[model samples]
Target: MNNKEKADEYFSKNKSKIKDSDRPVYHFTPDIGWMNDPNGFSYFNGEYHLFYQYNPYDIKWGPMHWGHAKTRDFVNWDRLPVALAPDDEIKGQCFSGTAITDNDKHILVYTVHSNDKEEQTVEIGDGVNYKAVSDKPVIGIDKLPKGFGGVDFRDPKIWKEDNVYYCIASAKNDRGFGSILLFESKDLLEWKYVGILFENDGKYGKMWECPDFFKLGNKYVLVISVMGMQARKRKYFNGHQVIYFVGTYDKSSYKFIPNGRGKTFDFGFDFYAPQSLYAGGRTLSVAWLHDWSNDLTLDGAKWCGQTTFPRELKLEGNDIYQMPAGELESHYKNKYHTSFILNRNKEYIDNDLNSRTARFDFDIENIDADKLTLFLAANDEYNSFIKINMKKKTLKFSRRFSGLCKDAIDERKIDIDICDGQLSLSVLVDRFSIEIFVNKGKEVLTSRIYTPLDANEIRFLADGKLKIDVSKNEIE
Candidate 1:
C-alpha cells in the first residue's frame, strides 16, 4: 500500500485507544494524534468540512498529513478519515492550504514540504478520500519571481471571484522579509502570477503565514499569522501573532490598500493561523487553539492541540465582532440567570453556575469600582482568574494555578475599553479551555487550562459597587 493508505490504516487502528472523556466537548481535535493549523475549511456535500495539519503516528507533530472532519452545524463534528498523506513518490508532507468547490468536486490547493523546497500542488476528492490531480508541482521553484525562494512559499489561500480563481501564498523575498504573492488560475492545475497582494513593512513581524483574504461587510480583510514578532507591548504578545488588515481589494488594480494598520485577530495566549469561510450569509472562522511551543500536551493525555470554537464574525466599525456559533444553543441543559448589586468587599459564589463545560454571559452594566475579579475553574486546590482593573484599563488572564507548566505560557494581559462604565463578558468554559469574549468580541481572549475536571467553581469579587446580570448555561 502507499503512504496514504498506510496512514488511514494507522489512524483507524489507533484512534480507539483514546476515550471521549479525554477530549473537549464542543471543540475539534484530531482523532488520536497531533493536530494543528486548520486547513481547507469549506462547505461541501451539504456540510462544513475542516481539514487540519495532522500527525497520526504519535501525539506530537511529525510528518504532516491532512486530517478531516465534517459538521452540519458548527458545534457537533463527525470525524472523517485521514484525507491526504505524504507521498513516497513526492517524498514530502502536505503542509497547509484552503479549498474551493468546483462543479460538485471539492478542489484543494496546498503546499507540499520536501527535503529543501516547498511547492504548491492540487488534489481533488469527494468528502472522504482525496488523490493528487497531478504528481508534479504546479507552481514550482522555477516559476517563482525574482527574490522569492522556495522554502518559505507555503500556506496557499485561494478564493474565487467571478469565473477566475485567485490564490495567495506567503514567501520571503530577497529583501529579507515576507511578502504575499498573488496568482490567478484559469484551471486548477495552472496558475499565473498577479503582483503582490500585501508585503510586510518590517514593523509587524518577519515571514507571514496562513493568509486569508476575504470580503466582510463592505470592507476587504486580509488575515495573516506572523513569525518573529517580539513582545514589546500589549500587542504582539505571542511573538507569533495572528493579525488582520482592513482594506479594499481593488479588483481593477488587483492590489490591496490598507486603511491604516493591522489589528490583533485574537488577544489570547493561544491562537494562531486562523482561516475564515463565508457560508450561509455569515463569515465563520476557527483557529488552532495553540501557539508555538515545544511543550504541548503529548506527555499529559497522549493527545495534543485543539481548534478554537467556531465563531460567527462580523465587521462593526472596522472591528470584527465574534459570536459563538448559534448552533451551540442546542446543547444548553440547565440555564440560570440572576441580576444583583455586587457591593464592595463582597464575594458571590453560585453553586448552580459552576461547571467546567458551561457558558456564562454576564453584563456589568454600571461600574463604580477600582477592580473586579472572577475566579473560574476553581476549587480549593486550583483556580484560574481574570482580573480587571478600572484605573489601568486592562484585564489579565492567568492559568498558573489551574495546573503546573514550567515551560508553557500561563498568562496574558490585554488593553480593555469599558465604554460608558459598562462591560459585557461572555465566557465559554470547556473541560480544558476557557474562551472569553469582551463586550461582544470587541476584544477576545482564549486560553487552555489543565486543571482537574472536577474543579468547577465560579466566584466573583469586587472592590466597589457594580450592577451585574449573569446568565449561566450548562453546555455539553
Candidate 2:
C-alpha cells in the first residue's frame, strides 16, 4: 500500500489505545499521538477543513503526516483519514502549508523537508484524499535568487489574483536573516520566482516562518512567526513568537510597503505558526497553541498539543482584533450571570462562575480602584490568575501556582491602556488552556495549562473599589 493509505490504516488501528479522558474536553485532539501546527485551514466541500502536522506513532513529534478533520461549525469536529505521509524523496517529511478551493477542486500547497533542502510542493484532492501534482518540487532552491538559503525556505501561503496564482514563502538570506519570497504560477504545476516581499530588519528575529499574506479591511497584512528572538521587556516572551505587519502590496511591482513597526497579535507563552483563511466573508485564524521550547503536557498523556480556539479576525485601520468564533456561542450551556460593586481590599468568590470548560466575560468600570485580579481554576492553595493594573497600565496572566511545570514558563504580561476607566475582558477556559481578550480584542493572550481538573474555583479580588458585570457560560 502507499504511504498515505498505510498511515490511515495504522492510525485507525492504534487510535483506540488512547483513553477518551486523556483528550481535552472541547479542543480538537487527533484520535492518537502528537499533533502541531494547523495546516490547510480552508473552507472546502461546504465544511471547514483544518489539517495539521501529525505524527500518529507517539505523543511526541516524529516523521510528519497531514492529519485531517472537518466541521460544519468550528465547535464540532469530525476526524477524517490521514491525508499525506512522507513521500519517497530521501526521507522527506511534509511541513507547514496552506490550502485553497476553486469549484470542486481542493488544492494543498505545502513544504517538503528532505535531506538538507526545503522546497514547496503541491497536491490535489477532493477533501478525503490527495496526490502530489508532480513527482518533483514545483518551487525549489533554484527558484530563489542569489543570496537566499534553501535550508529555511518553507511554509507557502497562496492566493489567486486575476486567474494567476501567487505564493509567499519564508526563506533565509545569506546573512542568516529571514525573508519572505514571492512567486507566481500560470497553472498550479510550475512557478516563477518573484522578488522578495519583505525581509527582516535583524531586530524581528533570525528566521521568519509561516508567512500568511492577505488584505484585511482596507490594507494588506503580512503575518509570520519569528525564531531566535530574545524576550524584549513585555513583548516576545517566548523564544518563538507570532507577529504581523500592516501594509500595502502592489500587484504590478510585487512589493509590500509596511506602514509602521511590526506588531504581534498575541502576547503569551505558547502561540506560534498562525494560519488565516478567508471563508464565509470573514477572516478566521488558528495556530499551534504550544511552544517548542516547553513540553509540559502531563506525563503519560497519550496526546500532546492542540490549536488555539479558532478566532475571528477583524481589522480596523492597521490593528487586528480577534475574538472567539461566533460558532462557539452555540456550544455553551449552564449560563450564569452576576453583577456586583466590589469594595476596596475585598474578595468575591462565586460557586456558579467557575469551570474548566466555561467562558467568563467581565465588563468593569473603575471606581477608585488601582488593580483588578480574576483567578481561574482555583482552589484554596492553587490557581491561575489574571491581574489588570490600571495604575501601571499592565495585564498579567500566570499559572505559577497550578502545581505543574516548575521549570517552564509560567507567567506572561502585556502593556495596556484603559480608556475612560472602562475595560472589557473575555476569558475562555478549556480543560487544558485559557485565552484572554482585552478591550474587545484590541489585545489577546493564549496559553496552555495543566492544573488538577478539580481545581475549578473562580474568584475576583480588587486592590480598591470597582463596578463589575460578569457572566459564565459552561462550554459543553
Candidate 3:
C-alpha cells in the first residue's frame, strides 16, 4: 500500500487501544489524531491555548494541522476547532510553527511543508510554506522574498521584544551545517532576514527543531531539540531533545553571545522536541516524551507520542531547573496516603497499593540500606523498579511489563541524588509514558514503557528502617 493507505490502516487498528483520559493523571491521544511538537502555547484572555501538530486524516504521523485546545483552567480543557489546517499549495503538510495574539486577535504563523510529487526537495522560492486553511492552502511561494536557502527552513516561533516581532526558525546551510534562521516582522506578515542565530558548524550535532528564545531570571536562554545524534556520543539521546544555551542577547547587534555547550533540559529517555513560551513572569516549557528513533511501539500502542506536564524553567547560577507549574496542584483531589513503611527486601508489604492514576509525594527522613527499590507495577516475576543505591548515592529506575515485543527489554537509568533536607518525587503514569518529577520538579525523568493494559500493582520497600510519608493524590 501507499503511504496514505498504510497510515489509515495503522490508525484503524489502534483506535480502541488509544488512551485519552480527561483526569489529570491520565494519558490522551488528541481527539483528532497524530500530534507532535507543542505549538502556540499561550495564556490569553484568562484562557490557556495549546496547539499541536495534528494529522486528522489518520492516526499516523503525516502532514500536520494546528490542532487546538483551550481551558479556563489547565484542568478542564475544551477541544476547539482545528485552528490551522492545510489550505495552501504546500503539497505534503503543515510542519510546525508558533502562534501569538496580534493586537487582541489570535494570529498563527507556521512552517508549511510542501513536497512535489516529482521532486525530493522543492525550492522554497519556487513554491512551498504559506498560510494554510482546512479546505485549501493559502498564499503562494512567489509571494515570499526571493533569497536564502528555503527548502531546509520551517517551524517558526515568533515573539515580541520592545514592540518588534522576532522569530527564530530551523534551517540548514549550503555547507550542510544546521542553523537557526532569524526573521523580523512588524505586522506578522512580511518579513526580513536578520542574521542566523547559530550556524550549523558541526559542533551542535545537526538540525535543530522548534527553536525558542526567552529570558529567565538574569539570563537569556536559547533552546532547541537536535536530531541525528547517537546516545554514546551525547548525554541524553532517545531521539530528539530539548537542549539549550544561556547567554546575553544584544538587540543592536541582533546576536546571541556564544556561551558554553548546550545542556539537556531533562535527563530522560523519553523527553524531546521541546518548545517554550514566556508568560506570567515565568517561562513555561513542554515536550513530546517519545523517541523518534526505534519507534517500535507506534504499531502496538496506536497513539505515537505524549507531552510532559507544563514546567516552569528557572536559571540558578548558570544551571537550568524545571519545576511543574504550581497551579497543577489545584487538580489534586486531596485524597492522600499516609501510613507507609518497608518490610522485606524483595517484596512490598504495606502502604497504599490502590489508585492507578494518581500522584505521590514522598519524603524520606532517615534510612539505612544497601539498596532501596520501590515498585510501581510489580507482579510475580516482572515489575518496574525505582531503586536507590545508597552505596553509590544514586537512584536508578527501569521498567518491565505486559507487552514486551520491542528489541530491547525497555529500560532507563539516571544518576539522581537527594538534596536540601529531603527528596521529593511526583509520579504520573499513563498507559504509555511514566513521568517522574524529582524534588518538586527540579529534576524530571520521562520514559515511555509499555505495560499490560491492566498492570496496576504498586508497592514500596527499603533495606532497613525506612521513615517516609507517601502522599497519594487522586485527580478529578
Candidate 4:
C-alpha cells in the first residue's frame, strides 16, 4: 500500500482507542498515537494552522507525519486530517518545519531525514488538501555546507523579508559543533546558500535543533533548541533546552549582532522546540508541553503529547515577555472570589477553589512574609506546591509528592522580584499539567504532574501577615 493508504487505515482502525477523559479540555493533543515538536504554525486564510510530528500507530515515537489542526481563536481547535506522510523513497520520516503564504498559495517547507542523507522538501496545499511540490528536495544534501555531514541538517524555518524568501536550518559541523545555516531565494522553487547566520561559541551546546529567526519590535530574535549542553548554575538543565537571543539584524549585510548571551526561553521542565507565527500584529508561540525525560509516563494512555497554551510574545528591553494569548477569559466560568489577611504561621483552605481544571488569579499586597506556599491538586494522598520567598525573591515548584509518577524531574526554581511589596500570580491547572505566570508573565513556569484523579483542593500558607485577594474560574 501507499503512504496515504497506510495512514488512512491506521486512523480508521485505531481512532476508537482514544478516550476523552484522558485528554485535556484546553490544550491541543493528538487523537491517537504520539505527537511532539509543533511544526508549520502559521495563520492562513483567516485561520491559524498548527502541525506537529506525529506517529499514528502507537503511543510512542515512531515514523513521523505532519499532524494538522486549525483554529479561529487560539483557545479552540479543530483537528484536520494528516497533512503529510512519509514516502517510500524517503524511507525514514518527515521532520519539523514551518509554513508560509505566498500571494495565493500556501506552502510548507520541511526536512526529510533518512538513514543516509537529510534533505529539504516542499509541499503546497490549502487548509485541507496538500500535494508534494516536488519529488526531489529543493535544497538537496549536496547543496549543504561542504565540511559538515548531513546528519543534523533539519528544521527549516522560512519567512519572507523585502520580497526575498529566507530559510534558516540547524546543523552540526565536522568538529561536532552546532551552527545555523542561512539561505535566500527569489522564488520558493530555488535557493542559494548564505553564510552561517549564527553558531555556538563553545558554551552553548553540541548540536542545535529547531532554529527560528524573526523580527520582534526593532530587534531580531533567534530561538534555538540546544542539545548536549551541561546544566549551568541555576540556569538551564543538562539536556535539550530552548534559548533565545535578542539582537539587531542588518538586512543589508544579512548579519545578526546579538546583544548578550541568550536567555532560557522557559524555566519549566516540559517546554521544547517552540515555533512562533506573526498573526494579527502579534508574535504568537506554542510548544510541545512534554520533554524527552517525561515521555515514559504516557505509555499506558492511547494518546501522548500536548501543546502549551498559545503565548503572545512581547519584547521588553533585552528580554521577552510571554502571556496567555487570545482572550482566555472566554473559556473560564463559575467565578469565585475572596479576600483575607493571613497572619504569621497560618494557613487558609477554601474548598470552593477546588477544581480539576481551573484558573487562579491572586493579588497580594502589604507582604511581610519571609515565604508563602500554595498547594494545588491536593488530596490526602498527593499534592504539588509552589513556594514563594519574598526576602530572596525566588519561586520554587515541587512535584515530589505528586502521585503516580516517579523518576522524573520534581523541582524547578526561578529568581523573581516582588514589585513594591506586591505580587500578582496567575495559575492554570489542567488534568495533568500546571502553568504558572508570575507577576504578569515576567517569569513563567510550565510543568506536568500526575496526581490522583480525585485530588482537587487548594491550600495557602504564609510565614507572616499579608493581605491577599483571590479569584478562581473553573474552565470547561
Please give each candidate's TM-score: 0.97, 0.97, 0.83, 0.97
lDDT for each residue of candidate 3 in 163-282, tens digit (9 for 90 to 100): 777877777556655677677767554556667676555656567777888888888888877776545432555456667788888877678774677777776667776777677777
Query: Over all chains combined, what TM-score does candidate 3 have?
Result: 0.83
Please list the C-alpha lDDT of all candidates, in the order they appear: 0.85, 0.87, 0.62, 0.85
lDDT per residue, candidate 4, 1-476, as tens digits?
Answer: 77756876788788777777788868788867889999999988888899999998878898899888899766678878888889876566899999988777778999998887777887889777787776788877777878779888999999887999899888888888888888888877788888788888878888889998988998999999888867786676778788999999876666777999888888888888999999789999899888886654554788888898889999999989888885677887999999999888877888888887888999888567888888889987788999988888888999888874568788988888797879999888888788888888877788877777689998888999889899999888
If the candidates were sorted by their lDDT against the true structure, best first, what order would they fall in?
2, 1, 4, 3
lDDT of 2 by residue, 18-102 (tens): 8767667677776678888999999997899999999887788989888999998776799898888896752589998999997
lDDT score of residue 382 within candidate 4: 82
* Candidate 1: tens digits of C-alpha lDDT, residues 15-108: 7789988888888888877888999999997899999999888777899999898998666788787788887766689999999877789988
What are the runs in model 1 whose C-alpha is more than 4 Å off?
298-300
After TM-score superposition, the amount by which residue 88's alpha carbon in candidate 3 deviates from its true location, in angstroms, is: 4.6
C-alpha-based local distance difference test score of model 3: 0.62
Pull out the clashing pairs in model 1: none
Which 10-residue span in candidate 4 carries the lowest summed lDDT? 292-301
Native-vs-model 4 lDDT?
0.85
lDDT of 2 at 246: 94
